[model samples]
Target: MRKNSIKNTRINGEVQKELSTIIRNEIKDPRIHPMTSVMAVEVAPDLKTCRAYISVLGEKEAKEATIKGLNSAEGYIRRQLARNLNLRNTPEIRFILDESIEYGVNMSKLIDDVTKKDSNSHRQDEEQDEN
Candidate 1:
């Protein structure tokens, strides 16, 4: 029943790339953080709604302000989408905060702590064996 046989991944990727570029180059909101980057995009099967995960490299308030700015500019963004993309309908875009980058940093720190502990324990064992 698929018309084009295009996979969801491809469609999602295309939407993500185009939206990110459009947001970066076109949007001129002062509240938008300069470090804002589109982390991921999830488009519905019918391509009517898209959830865009964004990472703002700043404090909580900055992130909030950036989201508010994006929300306010959603109409303009959608219009830009219509101009850039050839889809029959422009999907409603929802901005979401992506904490995966922070989570990954935390996870890496935990791993480093574990690794340091393991190395220290190995050193102590070797010293004991020498004595």
Candidate 2:
């Protein structure tokens, strides 16, 4: 059961794919990190605005630079998108930093640390009990 309309979903997928390609191959701004990716795209129902979630695999400064670069190139991106896709009006692109991947990685590391500590404590408890 999907909440979005079929048209919206299709548009979202197309926009995501096209944007990823554009960012990776077309945009040549040095400020844009090579490790940047279009994680997701959300287009408004009216198809006038689009929010692109970008994930950059780098330091804070690199991420900020990448976002700034992308924002500056929004018009170019929109033109490219319009050329590639036959949409009547290309949505106004907005770049947003997506940190879910980094958050997940940090959370995983924390869980692993806790698990290791628990195992070590259990081992010590077993040794004390045998003594």
lDDT of each: 0.88, 0.94
When summed lDDT is taken over every stretch of 10 residues in candidate 2, the lowest stretch is 1-10
RMSD of 1: 2.4
The TM-score of predicted model 2 comes to 0.96
Candidate 2 has an lDDT of 0.94
Per-residue lDDT of model 1, residues 1-131, tens digit only: 14244676777788899878877899999999999999998878787988999999889999999999999999999898888888767899999999889889989999999999999999999999999
- The Cα error of candidate 2 at residue 10, in Å, is 0.5
Query: What is the clash count of model 2?
Result: 0
Cα error, candidate 2, residue 42 (Å): 0.6
Indicate the residue-level lDDT of 51 in model 1. Answer: 93
lDDT of 1 at 22: 77
lDDT over C-alpha atoms for residue 89 of model 1: 71
lDDT of 2 at 47: 78
